[model samples]
Structures are given as structure tokens and as C-alpha cells.
Target: MSKTKESIFDYQLFKRLFEYIKPYKGVFMGLIVLVVLLAIFSSATPYITKDAIDDSITNKDTKNFLFYMVLMLGVLVLQTVFQLLFIYYAAWLGQNLVMDVRVKLFDHLLKFKMKYYDNSSVGVLITRAVTDMERIADIFGQGLFMIVRDLLTMAVVFAVMVYINVKLSLIVFAMLPILLYATRVFQKYMKKAFEEVRTEVSNLNSFVQERLTGMKILQLFTRETVEYEKFKTINERHKKGWLKTVWYNSIFFPIADLASSVTIGLVAWYGGLNVVFDGTNVSQGDLVAFIMFVPMLFRPLRQIADKFNTLQMGMVAATRVFKVLDTTSQIDDHGLIEADGFKGEIKFNNVYFNYVEDEDVLKGISFNVNVGETVAIVGATGAGKSTIINLLNRFYEIKGGTISIDGVDIKEVTLASLRTQIAVVLQDVFLFADTIMSNITLNHPEISEEQVYQAAKDIGIHDFIMSLPNGYHYNVKERGAMLSSGQRQLISFLRAYVTNPSILVLDEATSSVDSYSEQLIQNATDKITKGRTSIVIAHRLATVKKADNIIVMDAGEIVEQGTHNELLSKENGYYKNLYEVQFLQEEAV
Candidate 1:
């Protein structure tokens, strides 16, 4: 499912594109009818001119001349009406089609595992969801619909010319092969150019998105000038990609224009000769009509070449979008366990896992937490503390292991039901840019405003929320930037509490907060963990002192487990040594 290597006229791509149009078949059929009528009406104009000149003007019949003028006006009026209908309806169909595509793409994105996001660039995904969809929309609004209309116009124009005078028609068509060959060359080169242009667009998107999101870090490190130079490199690459497309267009259109001009010139030269020669069978009216029809024929061919680029760009976009849609990176959700109203005993039976292939983060780890037990896991950096929490949530598939809750393997339950029973609060809390109430309740219609208020009250953070300017309606802004870290942590506590999950996880939630906030969070934690199964991950030795059991981990394996005082009593033990260091450091501060 990497980027697609596609051609200019990909029949298979177009066949897939047509599937999206199937839902609007009625409107598509109507658009087809309008195209045929437009071509017919356009072709009628030249024939009317022929009649007005040969039968009305030349024969001195003013009545017939006036009648043909009225007929031409009627033909123009019909063309205008159908043209308007086609333009408006084509846009409508394109909008609906893009809407469906964008929604489908976003839904597919939601099902992907964390591994997919870990490897993907945010900017490239944004371009696929937004810019690429627009390109696909143009396939309908400007490319395919106009291509059909233009081809029909050429067909009708050629048919009328042959009927009027086959010899003159043959004379004009003599230069078509040269023009067709030029167009073919144009399509081949432009397709490659357009692909490069899209690649550069994705590159630029990735560069800008990363730089902007990390602007604070860039400023703090005073790396602005260095980063600017880096952006210039990417910008140059993007510029060159587009310039290649412009260069292609600059060469292509002139060749097409010259071929069109040469065809018109040849038609004029030979058609004029036939009108003047003594033995010529072609009439002046027929010659004039054939001359007019030359542009009608070549102009559409030129337009088709132009619209073909549009079609090609859309096909490239479709290929990228469909690749994502066809991805098999989603976690299997067919597990049948309901995961409701059960004892919350969790066990990790010889689990082995890694975020990256062949690099084990957790190696043959096993642990058991009985129902309603509070077990604190204390570990050094990269000792697989957070990895344990991620595994419990099934954010990743373990390489080899069985994680069970209440004697049932976690993988035997549906993901939704499994996740509904566990709530996680991490040290790096994330809050959407929304009202305080929405951040607390996540806009879950089932969690009412009164329930949110009561949860905050139970956690003893209700007064703090009411102290804000908008109370529950206060906007946290992006990433809760407007609030202090402790305030954000308290909001996370309320969020987890309101969920009422049977199993609770607090992963270093107290690591970064101030002493005052730590006390408040500890109070909240005591209330919530009273009757539930809890697994707390902490780096600070003092925070887990009151746990029912403490597990000391180093190098991805548990070295000791006992009550806090029992572990502290062992001479030269890892937990005892670590606890003494942290306790002395806090005492010194």
C-alpha cells in the first residue's frame, strides 16, 4: 500500500472511479442527456449558417433568412439552458462524492492500530484527507464530465462535416494523426510531472506541519535559523516539482496549438481552392461550413488533452486514498467476551512484546493482581512501565502472551467492551480544545451535566472548576494550554472517575505535579481506587508507599515484589536502594 505508480490513462483507475458515481446514477444519466443535447445544439449553428447563406441570402429570400435567424436563436437558448443545468448538477454530484470519500477515509483511519500512526507523518495524512480529496472532486466537476461533452461535440461536428462534403471533410482530417500523436506525447510527460508535483506537495505538508507543531521547542533551543534553512531545502524541492509541471505545460500546449493552427490553415487553403476551381463540386456554403467546423473539431481535442491532466491528477489521488482504505493494519475486533459486571482480576502470563520488530521492550513478563487489589509498579526509565499499561489496553498486539481479566483472555472480548471496563490516566494528559465540561464528559450524551458535577464533587475538584470564569463551560484551549499542569491533571481525574471503569490505571499521574496538586490528586485517587482494581505506575518512591503491593522492575523484568516496608527492610535490595535515594533527595530539597 505504498504510493501508486500510475499512468496517464489508467483504465482500471477510471473503472474504480466510476463506482463512486453509481450512487448518483439518475443525475449522471441526466448529465449524459444534457451533453448529447449540447453537442447537437452546437452542431446545428454551422448548418443554420449554411442554410442562411446558400438558401436565404443567395436566393434573395428575406423571409427564409429571418426564419433561420430565429431558429439559430432558439438553438442558442436551448444550449444555454442545458449548459447551466450541467454545470450546477455536476458540482452538486462532485460535492456529494467528495463528502462520502472523506468520511470513509476518516472512518478507516480510526480503526488503525497505534503502530500505523507511529510510522505515518501527520502532514501527509492531512493532505490525503483534504487536498487529495479536492483533486478527486475535480475528476467529476471538471475532468470526466467535460471530457464526455467535448468528445460528443467533436463527434457531432465531424458527422455534419462529412455529410456536407466528404472531400472537404477528408482534407481537414488529413492533419489529425500529427495532432493526435502530439497529444499522446503530452499525456505521457504530464502524467510523470503531475506525480512529482503531488509527491512534493506531501513533502512540503510534512515539513510545515512538523515545524509548526514544534515551534516552541525550536524557539527554546534557538534553532530558528537552522530550521529555516532546512525548510528552504524542502521548499526548493517543492518548487522544483511544480516547476517541472509548468515546464511540461509550457512545451505541450504550444505543440497542441501549432497542430490545431496547422489543421485550420490546411482546411482553409484546400476548401478555398475547391470553391474557386471550375470543376470543383464543393459549394461556397459547404466550404464555409467546413471551415467553421475545423475549430469545433480541434478545439475539443485540445480541451480533452487539458482535462486529461485533471483526470490524471485525480487518478493519482484516488490511488493514494484507496491504498489507505485497503490497508489491513487494524486490530481484530471480533473477540466475543462482553466484559461486564465481573471481578477485575488481571494476569499477564509470560508476555513478550516490542513496538518495533525484534527489539523486545517486555520480555517474558508475568504478574497477577487479585480482584480489588492496588499494585504499584516502580521502574527505571525504559524498564517497560508504560508498556505494561499499553498492553493492558490492547493498543498493540503482543508478540507472545496471554492477558486475562477474571480468567477470560482479554483478546476473547470485543475491543469496545474491553476498553469500556478500564480507564487510564497518564502523566502527559491530553485535553481537546473544548469546554471544561466537554473535556470531562467527552460529550458522551449518556454522561449528563449533573453526573459531571457530582464526579468533580466526589473527587473534591468541583470548587476549582467553579472558580474558573465559565465554570464547566470554560475552554481549556488546545492541549489545555490555558490551564496549569495540576489543573489539567485534576480534569483527567474527573474524566476517569466519571467513566466508572472496574479497572483503573494511573501511569505516573503524580510525577510532574506540585506538592499541593499531588495532595489533591492523592485524595481523589484514594476515593476512586477504594473498591476497584488499580494498577499505579510511579517513579517517585513516596507515592506508592501505601500500596497493597510494590513491584520493583529493572531491565524489563520484575526483580522483587512485597509490601513497601517489607521491600525497604531488605539490605542492598533494588527497591530499598532506589527508595532511600529519592527520600534523601526530597529531604534535601
Candidate 2:
């Protein structure tokens, strides 16, 4: 599933697309039968009228006319019935199929490594899953089957015309080649135009999403005017791409209509001459039928070109969608063992890793945390402090080394099992738009609401959560915007604690909050880290002072590892320098 350009009408793309139809194959076949019925009924209209005029009206037979009229009316009712059923089932199948694809796509995205999201645009991915998926629906909903029906009707109409009078049929088809050539040219340009349109659409969505998410930064810097102009430029390009398709459409349909009109006139003129002069060749009934047949034959051909817009856009959408579906960025699940645990003893042995190739972020890093021991990793940014936590949880693969839990290689265990035992509370806490209780339990059925309340009380945040507008049932509203930074951090701690994992990793949660909240977090940290194996990437000296061991890092390697007092005892050591600087800052404050 490499990302490759999919050609319009590529048989392979269609084959893959049709694979989705298996679940609804029975209904799909029923729709096809409906299409056949509709096309046959539509094509029989002119033939019925020809019989009514020639056998009933011309011969002055009132009973025959009445009978043919009844037959035509009956066929119309059947056509309507088939059409109603087709519309209902097609829509049903279209929406359900889209739902299945979207669900599978979302599941695929969830399995992808963090690196995939790091380099991919969120808005472009939305276009793929949401917008592009709708266009693909148009193919099954109407474009594909409807076009087939029209083509089938045209074939039947053309056959009847030739059977009625071959000379007049040739006159009608004289104008056919010119319209088909125009359609061929129209399709070529429309495909290119739509591809450009799709590109611009993705660009516009990406630009807007990025800007809206970063609107705070833009407003703080007063760059609204600059960004607004950029938005206009991108929007104008999107508009121009769509206008090109409109331009082609404007040129194409008129030519088709004109071709049909001219063909009708030619058929009428030739048929009229035979009717007025040659008594044997064409009748008045036949002349009327030829006029009716010309439009029927050309209408589908014209609409085929129009309906192609759906197919062309669908082709473009499918290409972009398949590219995302084909991305090889998901973290491979390598083994079969299911992990359940008692103790948390983590080991990272000679780990080498990088986000990009050939540039190591963690250089042969090695560390060990014993069972029930609390270790704090301390360093400045880019010293690979956070990278250690990332590797421990297998957020990213290590280039060289082994990370194991309880002496079992983490890769050998199922990811869901391995991850269930580890909980991480990052520096930037994220809360979903959900109730406080739901956020704490993460809707995990094992943890009851009673457990959530007890856990909140144990960690001493029960009063704080109860003080909110709805107690634990309060909706946080979009990443917890209604709560203060400290409030969000407290909620994250409660979330991690209720999981009751064998291992807990806190990525310096206390550094960004006010002093009161910091004190609360410190108390919660003391309570939760009592017996679990905890790794705290600490920013403040307070949490680090209590650690069983301190690992000091600098530029992707461990500079020192020892107790806080032992590190302070060393003269001119890395930890000594860090401790002295922090002490001076505290004294000055």
C-alpha cells in the first residue's frame, strides 16, 4: 500500500474499491436489477407511442388506442416503483459503506506511531477521511449505477431507431461523433481541473485549521492582517480551480444539446421527405417517433458527460484517500504474549534512537529502575529527558537497545497489555470534552463511579472537583478550557491514579502551575507513588529530593546517577552545579 498516483479508471483501483461491496452484495445485486427494469421501461416509451399512433390512431381503432394508453400508464407506475426502491437502497448502502470505511480508517490512525502525526497535517487527514469519503459515496450512490442505466437505455433506444428506419437513424448518428469528441476533451481537462481543486481544498483546510488552533498566538502578535491576506490568496486559488470546471461545463453541455437538436432536425427533414413523397418508407407515426427517439438517444450521452464530474471528483478523492490508507507509519505489533503484572521493574539497555535517520537523539542510553523504586530524570530541554519517558512507554521505537518490563522485552508483549500497566501524565495535560468522572475513569467499565469518587478523595482533590458547577459530573468542554491550568493538572493526576497501573510516569506536571496547585500536586504525587514503580521527569527540586535515585542527563547521555545528597557532595559535578543554581534562584525569589 505504497502511496502511488491512482489513474482515473484504473482497473486495480476499481477492484480494490469494489472490495467494500462484499458486505452488501445482495442489496447491490438488487439495485442492479432495479436499474435494468428502469432502463427497459424508459426505452420502451417511444416504441409504445409509435404503436399507439400507427395501429390505433391511423387505423381509426378506438379500442386499440385505449388499450395502448393503459399499457403506457401501467409501465410508468412500474418505473416509478423501481425508481423509489433504487433511491432508498442506494442511499442506504452509500452512507453505511462510508461509515465502515471511516471507522476502519480511524482505527488505522489510532495504531500509527506518534511520528506519523508529528509530520502529517491534521486538516489534510480530515479531508481524506471526511470530505474525500463523501465523493467516493457519490460513485456508488448515483454516478456508477445511474450512468450504467443511462447507457443501457441509450443502447435500447438506438436499436429501436434503426429498426424503425435505418436511413433516418444514420442521419441522427451523423452528429454523434462530434459530441463524443467534445466529451472526451471535456473529461481530460475536467480531471486535471478537479485534481487541482482537491489540492487547493486540502491546502485551504490545513491553513485554516492551523490558524484557528494558533489564533491566540496570531492575535497576541497582531498578525491577523497578514494571515487574512494569505487566506484570501489560498481561497482565490481554490475558486479558480472550480471555475475552470465550470468553464468546461459551460462549453460542453451546450454543444451536446445543440448536437441533439441538429440531429433531431436532420431526422425530421429526412423522415418528412419520405413521408410526403415516398409512401412506403416513413409514416407520420414513424416521423413523430424519430423526433422522440433523437433526444432519448442523445440525452444519456450528454448526461454521461455531466455525471462524469462525480466520477472524476471521486477518482481524485479516491487517490488521496488511498494514499493515507496506504501509509506505512503504523507501529507494527511484533508478538503474541499478553502481559499482566505484579511488579514494575523497567530497564533501558544501551538505547539509541532518533526521530530522523542518522541523527541520534538518545545516544546508547542505559538506565534501570528497581521494583517499587521512584527515579527522577532531570535535565534542560533537548537533553533527551522526555525521550527517556517516550521510549519507556514505546511511543517511539529505539534505533538500538532493549526496553523491557519485568525482564520481558516490551515488544514481545501485546501493546494493549503492555500499555495498560503504564500511565503517563505529560506536562501539558489534556482532558476530553467529558465529565470529570468519565475523564477520571476514561469510561473504563472496570472502574466504577464509586471508585472514581474514592480515588479523588484519597488524592485530596474530591473537594475541588465537588466545588465545580456539577461536581464530578461537570463537562470540561474542549480540552478543559473552562478549568484553570492547575485544575487540568489535578484532573490528569486523578486520571492516572484510578488506572492503578504497575508503573506511573509523570513528565514534570508541577512546573507550570501556581504555588497552591503545586503543593496539591506534590501531595498527590506522594500518595500515588507510594508503592508503584514511578519515574518522575522533574522540573522542580522538591520532587527530585525525595527520589530513591536521581539520573542527571546532558546532551543525550547520563552525566550522573546517585542519591540527592550524594550528588550534592561532589564538587564541580553536574548535579552540584544544577543544585547550586536552583538554590540561588529560590533564595533570590
Candidate 3:
């Protein structure tokens, strides 16, 4: 994923994150109440101790001392209860918020245009959806809630200390400005370090994912050592990124600790002198209570600084997540026309398209296929054959002309209805790491096992499926790695047929299949295209000789269109030349 420099406080991002928490406001409010109660209980403990020491212990009133002791124990128990409630509810709220975020992000990705995925990394997307979400959860579960809790405790402790002995309280707070300055500097450096660390983590994940996905290619080319060296460099950068954060942690916390220690020492020294020498104002119990109050005040201050890191990192992660969620590069689906009863009459009128800016792949192309007609487009690589199929399906919108089905522009129909009516099988078939049956039905409960078997039987690949270790129950293992390319292609054919689409598309679908699988695919193709409009994009001229129309393309323009025999009859036609060249190549092979 790409990133821009971000500020430490992204107010907009934080505001967006809080929207997820809105659904759980009642629980959040409960947490806030618990935090305030916990603070009150905590602050009361030191004062209770002061009273016990000065009024009960020193005076030697046995019954009253015992009474205060039990009262102190009860306060501690209540404090523990509130602490436990805060932890539990804070975690509950965080988990629910992360779940909402992850679901929303995934839903957004599903709607993004093909161009976005073309330019993005799978691993980086995974990091944002999974790992970054976990960090966001930590903000509420461990970071934000705890920071608030500590701050409340400290503030309550401070007010009580001032009430007990205002002069001593002033002396204890004298080191606060220095510690605050150190914390500010620490935050600035740590934010930069953590941002770098996040970037490195995304990079490392992307590198590992790509390398592993292409490990077979790497091994075939004997590039393992080079790849490993590259991984080490990435790993080193990742380590260095984290180390920078650790360095800041090492510097920041100790400075906070030292300031805390100095404050404690000063409070004890001044309060102790007033108790022993001056004896006019401060009591022994007041000095004791202030000493106890010092840690409560300074410890939270130090922890607030620590917890701020969590808050900052979550904010950064949230910003990245929101950037993706806010992306506008999704396929436009403004068409209100429902694609019910589509007749599958596809026509492209002088279409122009480009995958990249100002570089047209298909130029001034015009063609039409009537309902139930089979049209084959044959062209050399990069001659705009596949681009036509892509445009017809509205995978990429054409720049200059209209693509229509049943005389209604495709862009005028709802995408879901349009895409659902069309089925496409490309040269490379992708399968998930799931059981064959699940892959076939896509776990759609409406598609029964019987329907799948019938589709496979009709396609004549049922026996091939049975030959597998567990037939339909067998796991394909990521990207169908466990299956041969031919087997995967057969599966793809079965999948397309099962959808019972109105218009079928085969873009060199049999190119990867073996001769035996090719025969089966040809048979399946015939059965599926029997009464539906189908477009076949093929390189092998022989396979397309039986097509209803053979359209020849050259340099992004349609050069010839006719039945195979008619095209071949033209003495110097491009189709005739292409067919002869392919026929010779086949003979040579």
C-alpha cells in the first residue's frame, strides 16, 4: 500500500474511528462510569490510610483502628471490582469495533474496480484488513481506555494532595514541566518511527507473499539465494524500524522515572521537615498520605505517555484504513435498469478503450453478435482481442462508444444483474484453498451437491473429478496448486456452466489444457453455448473454424469478418494469412 506523510493527531481519522464505537455507546458509557468510580475509590485509599495512621494508630484506639483497617480492605476490594469491569467492557467494545471495521474494509475492497487491484498488493491489503485492524482494537482495549483511567486517577490524586497540604503539593509538581517536555519530544520521534515500522511491515508481508506465491518459478530459475538476500535486506530494515521505536522508549520512560523519583524525594523532604521541625502546619499523617499520593500522581503521568504511543499507532493505522475505504476508484454502478429477461444481443459500436492513459488498446472497433450466435475473435497477442471481451462485460468501460445487450446499453443496467447473467472462463483459473465442492458452488447454499454433480456430468468431467483423492471433498489447496492446469481449467468450465449464464465468454479458456482435457472442454463448450450468446477469444485458428462468425483483428482494428470458409476465400485477407500461419505452426509442432 502507498502512504503519504501523516500528522501525529489526525482528527478526522479519529472522528471516523469513533463512529464504529457509536453503536456500542451504552457499553462505552458504562466503562466511563467505571473509570470515574475506580478513580474515586483509588483516591480515597491514601486518605483513608492517613486517617488510620494519625487518628487510630497513633492515638492507640484499638476498636477504631480495626474499624478503619476493615474499611480500607473493603475499599480495595471495590477498586478491584471496578478495575475488572473496566478491563472486560473496554475489551468487549474494542473487539466489536474492530469487527465492524474489518467487515467494512472487506466490503469496500469487493466493490473496488479491477484497476485498483491491478495496482495494489494482496499482502498489503491483508495487512490493512487484519493486522492494522488489531492495532486499532488495541487503542480502545489497552491504550485509550487505560490512558483515560490513569489520567482520572492522577487528577483525583492531585486534587486530594492539594487539599491535604497545598505547600507540599506545589513542591511535588515542580518537576512536571520537564517531564512533559521530554514526553513531547519522545512522541514526535516515536510517531515517525512507528509509521516507518508500519510501512516496513507492509513491505515485508508483500515481499514474502509474492515470493512464496512464485516460489516454483524462483526454484526453476535457481534464484533462491538472490531472493533470500533480498528478504534479509527487507528484514533488516524492519528490525531497524522497530529498533528506532525501542530507542525512544528507552530514553522516554527513564526520564519520566527520574522525574517521578525526584518529585517523590522533594515531597518527602519538605513535608517531613514541616512535620518534625516546624510542627505548626503539617501533621505526620499528612506527610505520609502525600508520600503515598506521589506515585499515584506520577505513575499515571508516565503511563499516559506510554499509552499515547498505542493511541498514535492506532491513529496511523486508522488513517491507512480510511484512505482505502474512502477510495473513489470503484466501478460506476449508477444504472437503474434491472437486467431481467436479457436476450444476450451484444453490440459494440466504434468502441475505443485503453488500460493506461492515452494508449488505446481497442480503436474504433465495431461488431455485433445476435442471440444464440457464437462469435470467435482471433488476433495476435496485444492485437486487442481480450480487450473486446473486457469491454463487453463492462470490466473496463470503453472511452468512445456504447456496448449494448438487447439494444440497451450495458452501462445502463445494474452491474450485479449484468454480471450475474454473464459467465466468463479465462485462460488462468483461480481456485481457493477449499474443498472442491465448496469451490464449485462457492458455498452458496442454494447450489446443492446434486446440481454440481449434474453440471459436471453434463460437462463430462465428472470422472476426472472422481479420480481425485477425495473427489468433490478434496481440498484444492491455495490457487488450486494441488490440481493440474488442465484439471483446473476443467473445473473452471464446470463452474461457468453451473451458473447457467445468458452470455458465455471463453478467453483462450482451453489454452492451458492438455489434449485430453481440451476435448472435454470443447464438448462442454458445445453443450453450454447451445442456446446462449457466446464470445470465444482464441489464438488457435483451427479451434475457431466452426464459429458462426470469425472476426479477425490487427493493430486494435477489426480487419475482416466472415464465416471461416468465407474469410479464407478472400485471396489476400488477414484471416486467411493468420489461419495459414497457425495451421503451419500446428503442423510443425
Give the range where candidate 1 is weakest over 10 consecutive residues by summed lDDT: 1-10
Q: Lowest-scoring 10 consecutive residues by lDDT in candidate 2?
A: 1-10
Give per-model TM-scores: 0.96, 0.97, 0.97
Q: Model 1 misses residue 35 by how many Å?
A: 2.1
lDDT of 2 by residue, 532-567 (tens): 899999887778889999999998999999999999
Query: Model 3, which residues run further than 4 Å from truth?
Result: 1-7, 587-589
Q: Taking the tens digit of each residue's C-alpha lDDT, what string does model 3 give over 1-589? A: 2233445566667677888888899999999999899989988888998998889888988888898899999999998988898999998998999999999999999888777988999999999999899999989998888998998898899889888888988887787788878878887788888889999999999999999999999999999999999999999999999999989999988888888888888877887888889976788888888888888888888888888889878877887888899898778999999886678888989898988999988899899999989899988889998878777777777789888999999889999999888989887789999989988888877788999999999879999999999999999999999998878888888888888889999876655568998788788878888888999997565458768998889989999999989998999988888877885576477
For candidate 1, lDDT tens digit of each residue in 81-166?
99999998988888889899899999999989989999999999999999999999988898899999999999999899889888
Question: Which regions of candidate 2 are displaced past 4 Å?
Answer: 1-7
Report the CA-based lDDT of candidate 2 relative to the real structure. Answer: 0.87
Model 2 residue pairs with clashes = none
Model 3 / residue 379 / CA error / Å: 0.8
Tell me the lDDT of candidate 3: 0.86
